[model samples]
Target: MRKDRMILRTPLPDRLCHWAMVVCFFLVALSGLSWLFPSLNWLNGVFGTPQMARVLHPFFGIVVFAALVYLFIRFVKYNLFEKEDRIWLENVKSVTAGDHSKPLRIGKYNAGQKFMFWGIMGLICVLLISGLVIWRAYFAHLFPIPVLRVALLLHAVAGVGLMLLIIGHIYLAFWVKGSIRGMVTGYVSHAWARAHHDRWHDQISGKGADKTKPGSAR
Candidate 1:
């Protein structure tokens, strides 16, 4: 619980952007769901009224897409695959069991997180393109009836896919003890970082079993 023992994980701006996107994503998602299901139509109250939800959903969806773009640009470097990631992939079951005894050489993100990051990005891109094509207010008139139907189908599928991914993301964020705290406060304990992201912890703290030690000694 020592403040001095914490290392910066998410910075303030990124944290702000993340929470903002969360809000926008939920509002847009719920509103879209309201339109898609008669039973869920009441969910449009997220924007006060069904009509208002209809008017606001697309705009909020655009905001979510823009925020994700910023996040992708900021975090893409940490999410790239590396040779060490193969070790993590091989022993993923151990990781699922909450065992860090294996030296997975995890960096700022593990392979699983990298995959989720890219998956979310890819689905959002799909949603944006399809949404644009089917947007009745602005673009639908330009497209033929058959094209609009196709776009609508694609948009629905991508939206559902993204929602599923976000659900898993939420579950993992809460399942990991310190993960949510790191996102909320922009810092995490050295021990938490070492346990979850050993290689990154070593690189940032300049200590531990870093491969660089052998090179330096030589």
Candidate 2:
């Protein structure tokens, strides 16, 4: 049965923070490229010079970390695991095929997204710690030489991992048709919700059957 549309999914602050993080990540990526590859000299033009990028990357890393921390704190509850996650994980193939039968009946986030949330959080922690260790003007010399070496290697690995995760994140967002719109406009249609998240849809729209509502029939 077809249903009406919804108003919005994400809140304004969430959307704003998401975009800000995107911008900051892009800046960091560009700055890294400018210095990481001497052969790719043209990248320096994006930030005026390689030296200039070196100066700015750390500053914007702080910005990205702060914005990401805000997003993490606000959405942490939404990403917590629920019992339905097991069903969702087991039905991954069917779910990808667009199956909604006995759908997991998730609340805020599904299993896959919850995994991503924690994975990214770990990446952020690693990035921040390693970043501080190698921050030449700040703490590079304070740490022992052995520790600094390990930190540099870890920073490189974390950077690569985050980039790959980001690509996957964008892919998933676009894969779910209404997802991009949620982050872009902070709203979603009722139909989109019902089709994609039937259980959540019913709760939000006060549909025929809603388990989340009090005094409702099971």
Candidate 1 wrong stretches, greater than 4 Å:
207-218
Model 2: ten consecutive residues of lowest lDDT: 209-218
Writing each residue's lDDT as its tens digit, candidate 2 over 1-218 gives 21123455677787898898899898887676656667865776656766877777888888888888998987787687877678889989988897776756765567898899888888988988999999998889899999999998898888879888988999999998888977787667766666666556666666564534321211
TM-score for each predicted model, relative to the true structure: 0.93, 0.87
Q: What tens digits encode model 1's per-residue C-alpha lDDT throughout 117-202?
A: 99999999999999999888998999999999999999999999999999999999999899999999888898888899888887
Candidate 2 overall Cα lDDT vs. reference? 0.76
| TM match of model 1 to true structure | 0.93
Per-model tally of clashing residue pairs? 0, 6
